[model samples]
Target: MDYLTATKNKKYLMYISQNYSYAILRPLQQEILAQGGEVKWFLEGNEVTSSFLKNNESHLLTIEEVIRWSPDVSFVPGNVIPPFIPGIKVGLFHGFNSGKRNRKGFEDHFNIRGCFDLYCTQGPNTTSRFEQLSKQYKHFAVKETGWPTLDPLFNPDTKSIYTQPDDKRKTLLICSTFSRNLSLAPKLYQTIKTFSEQGKWRILMQFHPKMPNELVTKYQALENENLTFIETDNVLPLLKAADVMLCDTSSILLMFILQRKPVVTFCNQDPGKHLLDVTEPEKVEAAIELALSHPAQLMDDIESFCQQLHPYQDGLSSQRVLAACNELVLTNPKLKPKPLNLIRNLKMRKKLNYWRW
Candidate 1:
């Protein structure tokens, strides 16, 4: 019997190690449940808050429990998944590539960790690169299914649990990456504080979870009538509410730009015509003004950039992802097998204390 035909009740495991994974995989989970598939979550580390899991959502607490559950497939948003997990491991990346480089100066986004059996790429830029890597690795498959996280961003009917502030002020969202060297949080602090003091825009500041608590506290202190600091795992609502975004090299900026809205980025690593890249803190105010103005050329560049990044506006990427997974299972492509990855697997086993082979 074919894989899809034989499986009456498909069991899917959402393997998460970070808080952001919840937002990335929830849309896919919704699709799974709608299709009569059983979906369970397996949170590997303390970083992922258990409370985020809904009452109806099931979670496997231990590795032993996961082994017994025997899922048909596992979706991982983070880089690594234990090879011991009994499933076809699929990589659902946590975020878009924001041109951040690793310590070794290599593009971290395209780095293959020898774990996933398949990669559901976001768009043409990522798909073309992963396709090239797929050819070289010959171990995994690449499918250009849009990122599932943005399903709600594109879906107008989807009601957000988050309520934007009632104020009618033009919202200016400020976000920064956690990377110290790449972050503009510290550098642009005075400028943003001044902006809040002006009370011309409603400043909504949110930083990456991994950002230093000291810096977070510093920004939190800037809260006043004009400024509000937001802390949440899901940033979709904020993306929709904001008119203009001021960011550093964080991938969240990419998500904001996908709305075809203008963004003012500070010293972006890969500055493009799509963004209003400002070098100095003093230039930020002017950049924000230009972005808010929505210049004809700038808006055109943003639209063109978004097309290459994520063209799917239908919000049905989750369905496409499921279809891709089903097709892969049915075909059972004869690709090169994944590496043993003994060191990585050993580290994972030690972390989980699962020794049974």
Candidate 2:
């Protein structure tokens, strides 16, 4: 039988606690609906303000309500899967692990703390590591499914098309991560300010939502006729609009590479050959020029990098993820919620105020 035919009425409980998680899981939620499955969202703590729930109010349900529903599968983009939640806890992950900033903790990215019954990996870079860890831990099933969040980038109907503005100046997008040590914003502000004033390029700046409001305000004040500051959960549109991407250690650098576009990184922690790493402030302008002047020069390297990162650029990753979920639901015995991690549970309850005598 076909995939959708098999998942006609499957139930999916998506647990999200941040805009980043919502963005990562939103595509899969839509795909579930298309497959005739019932998908409900449970926002943890402050995630209720997520734009995903803005239009999807009807689909919102409380955590208690979710438990009673006992969905066939519970997907979490963030690290911790809710303790005692019914069904298979699947780790869908939030972003690509580019090994940026010398981050060695799996908890921040790939660590499985008995939270998930299954893990959907983005590519070999992640899958190989998780597979080893899975064997060592003897817990959780790992599947190599390219990130569902990026599926829309490859979809013909949904893919963003870049259109040059009327003035014809190439668009430059500068994105920074939240980590102050790795973020390029504070250090590059003067360089960007100089460039923004020149009017030689159309500049777009996007920062991690977790970035402090003080920093955001500091950058927002820099907006001018040539420079625009963007603050939104969705980045695909911005990615599609830019002719070149300037970034630090953020995984969006990998996404930009997948677009076959040139990316200039500011001393990326986990440096990739394709990315033009610029350390000196004076060299930033020259790197941007090189990218715009010779995009063809790096096409081969970018394609090779993308192949190792995520080979399925055809936009069906969401389908594959849903298929895996459905198959596990039908074939595997219903998973009984494992014994709760008392410490983790208490921490979560305190965080979400789920206290009950």
Winning candidate number (lDDT): 1
The true-versus-predicted C-alpha distance at residue 195 of model 1, in Å, is: 1.1
Model 1 C-alpha lDDT per residue in residues 68-143, reported as the tens digit of each score: 9998889999899898888789998889998989989989999999999999999999999999999999999999
Q: Which runs of model 1 end up more than 4 angstroms from their true locations?
A: 1-8, 159-166
- Residue 196 deviation, candidate 1, in Å? 1.4
- Name every residue pair that clashes in candidate 2: 106-111
TM-score of each: 0.96, 0.92
Give Cα-based local distance difference scores for all models: 0.90, 0.80
Backbone clash pairs for candidate 1 read none
Worst 10 residues of 1 by lDDT: 1-10
lDDT of predicted model 1 = 0.90
